[model samples]
Structure formats: C-alpha cells, structure tokens
Target: MAIRMHAALRRCTWLLALGWLTSLPATAALPEDPFRSPMWEYNLARYLGADAAVRHSDTVVIKTPPFAEDATQVPLTVDLSAFPHEIKEVITWVDLNPVPHLFTLRPEAAEIRTVALNFRIQQASTVRAAVRDEQGGWHVGSVHVEAAGGGCTAPSATASNPDWADSFGQVRGALFSPVGGVTGTRLKVQVMHPMDSGMVGNIPRFNIETLELRQTANQQRLASMALSESASENPLFVFDLEHDAQQSGILLLLRDNGGNLIESRMGI
Candidate 1:
C-alpha cells in the first residue's frame, strides 16, 4: 500500500510540470529578410554572433544610391532618429566585399542621431547597419547597391599621387547649426589618408584604426569609432549630435595602424 501511494505522487508531479510548461508564452519568430540575399544568414551569424536576438526594423534606416556612380566612393548613411529605444552601439558592413567589415560606432557622452561615410565595394552588394538597443536586441536595416567591379583591388587615387604624403593625416572639419529646424549640431569632417586595402600589388593595408570626438575644453570623449580597410581613400564623415550648449567646441582625434596621429578642433 505504501509503494502504491509513492507512485501516485510521482505521476501527479509529472503532470503538473507538463501543465506549467504548456501555459508559458511562446517566443516570437524573427522577421524575414526583406532583401533575401544568400549572404544574409552567413554574415548575420558571422558578425552579430549566432545567438544574437536580431530583427528587421523600419526605425533603423539605411540610405544609399541604388546604383553606385563611383564604386570606390559610394556614400552611405544610417539614421537612428526614429528608434524607440536608447542605442548602445552601431555597426555597418558590406555583404560581398573582400573586407566586409566597415566601421563600428559607440556613442559615449553624445546622442548620435545620424552617421554618414563613404566606402568602397568590390562588387554589387547589400549593405547593412545593425543598431543595438539598451535591451541587447539588434535592430537591422539593409539596402542593396549595384556597382561595377574592382573597387577594392584598384589602386587608391592618393597612392598614385606624387605628393600624397605631403597632406597625410591632415584633418578638416566644420560645425553648423542644426539643419531643417532640427535641434542639434551638424559636424562634417574629412581625413586625408591612402586607406590602402593591400589588395593591389605591393600596397600594404594602411588605414585609420580608431577615431574619437571629444569636447575641446575637458577632453571628454563624446563618441568613438573603429574603422576598417573598406573605407574610401579620403573619407568624409558626417555626424549629427544632439544639441548641448556645453559641447560647443569639438575636437577630432584619429590614429592609424601606421602609428600616425591627427588632431584638429572646430568651434560652434
């Protein structure tokens, strides 16, 4: 009689556990890729990790020319103004380039609304921008660009110039009041570099590895970025910073893999 009573208790516990599991909510499925490129799955797992919680979001906007007039200097813009959550980080990459990784931007003391840069593409490819929110979810935006071949393997225009080294590491920047009645400051900066991808014969990979924007008065870093070889020869970067009177004066600092440092200042 005691043995029979123990078996009945065990059966009751098993049924209760099953019921609890069935009552739990099911996880939502990830959204399908709009572009549906073959490289989508591979690049997603490779760059964002296989276990990342990623979903396609309309709030993360990626803008680029449908047909690239200049493959080596294609312009790309990522706008995050419509994101409902606080952004933690932003990453951009080209799907089919030899060196696919483009840049990673982390906002420190600044609220980055929009970022724009020029990059090279080896061929027609899909470009992606993934924004990570405070809750550790990745919101992705993608756009397809058509281009001719040889953007990566071609020799840089700066490298062919006889006086390329004369203006190396030079920086020019300007600050403007917010445009379109927006409540922020607009910063445009250009850095002179060969940005060699080493794909061409005898050209070693030489490009800016790190860049930082800081407050000129206290040297407090507002934002930082890590760049890769896929960037254009002389990169033009545009940033939209949230309005802050205390952040009137800005400093730009850039360092390359060749141990070269460039610094410049711009005042609002």
Candidate 2:
C-alpha cells in the first residue's frame, strides 16, 4: 500500500506540473511578410541583426507615394506618434537599392514623433522603417514604391552645376508652429551638398555622414542621425521636435565623409 501511494503521489505531481505549463500564455510566432519581398529575410538579418525580435506593427507608419515620380527624390515620412512604447532607435532602408541602408536615427534628448527625408531608389523597391522600442523589440513598417530605375547611378543635379561648390554646406532652416494637431515644433532644414553615390562616373561618394540638432544656448544635443549615400542630393530633412520654444534656439550641425562640417543656428 505504501509503494502504491507513493506512485500515485508522483503521478499527481506530474499532472499538476503539466497543467501549469499548459495554462501559461503561448509565445507569439513571427507574422507573415505583408510586402512579400524576396529580400525580406536577408535585409532583416543584415540591418537589424539575425536574432532581432521583429514584428509587423501598425503603430509604426511609413508614408510615401505608391508610385515615385522621381526616383532620385522620393519623399519618405516615418511617423511614430502612435507607438505606445518609448523608442530607442529608428532605421530606414530601401531593400533593392545599391546602397540599401538609408539612415539610422537615435533620439537622445528629444522626442522624435516624425521624421521626413528624401532618398534615392535604384529601382522599384520595398522601403522599410524599423523602430526599436525600449524593450529591444523591433517594430517594422514597410511600403512598396514603383520606379523607373537609375536613381542611384544618375548624376546629381548639384554635380552638373558649376557654382555648386559656392553654396556647398549651406544650411537653411526654419521652425514653424505645429500642424496636424501635433503639439510640437516643426523644423524644416535644407542642406546643400552633391551627395554623390559614387555610382555615377568619376563622381566619388560624398554625402552627409552625421547630423545633430542641439539647443543653441547650452549645446544640449536633442537628436542625432547618420546618413548614407542612398540619400538624395541637397537633402531636405523635416523633424517634429518636442521642443517648441522659439527662444530656446536650435543649432544644426552636419558633417560629411570628406571631413567637412557645417553649422547653423535657427529660431534665435
């Protein structure tokens, strides 16, 4: 009887353990690709790393034209206003472009709700914006754009102009009142550069490598971004910053791969 009771007790303990395991929530499987691109897996591993925890998220919205009229100047807007979690970093890329990586933005002392810029597309490609949350999970948003091709290889308009060097590294920026119900300042900045992709004949790749926005008073960095050759020439960047005071003043600093630095002040 003692042996039988001991055996019964062991069986009951095993059953309890199994029940507890079954009651716990199941781990979520990765979602299916919405764009169905062949390079999805490869690009994901290449840019976001092989072991990144990724999922398709509606909160991370990528707004761009379905058909790109000019592949060299296709506008892209990444909106993270609806994302519930705190963002650590944002990376944008074109899957089929010769230089696939576009830009990586790390919000240091600012709240970046939206980021807009123009980029070059080699062909009809899938564009992706991957936002990394505080928990290290990457939420991805993707869109497809149809193009006629040759955007990356084509010579920039700035390259053909003889006087381009005269205005090179010039920065023009303005701070406007917030629009579209957003409660922050809208900063639009245009930088003059050839932004050569080196794909064009005899034009070596020259582009802005790093950009920083800071408080003019204390030089406190608000945000910083790293750009690549995939960006368009004379890049126009739009950032929605949480800082709205015109008196606080904002400083723009840009650096190129050739060791050129441009600095300007706005909202003074």
Q: What local distance difference test score does each model get?
A: 0.89, 0.90
Q: Can you give the TM-score per candidate against the true fold?
A: 0.87, 0.87
Q: Which portions of model 2 show Cα errors greater than 4 Å?
A: 1-30, 179-182, 244-246
lDDT of 1 at 210: 96
In order of listing, the candidates' clash counts read 0, 0
Stretches of candidate 1 exceeding 4 Å from the true structure = 1-30, 179-181
lDDT by residue for model 1 (1-268), tens: 9999999999999999999999987654556778777788788788887767899989999999998888889999999989898888999999999988999999998899999999999999999999999988899999999999689898999998999989988888898776587677788999999999989998899999999989888888889999999999899999998735644689899999999898899884
lDDT of 2 by residue, 223-247 (tens): 9999999999999999987863445
Ten consecutive residues with minimal summed lDDT in candidate 2?
25-34
Poorest 10 consecutive residues of model 1 by lDDT?
A: 25-34
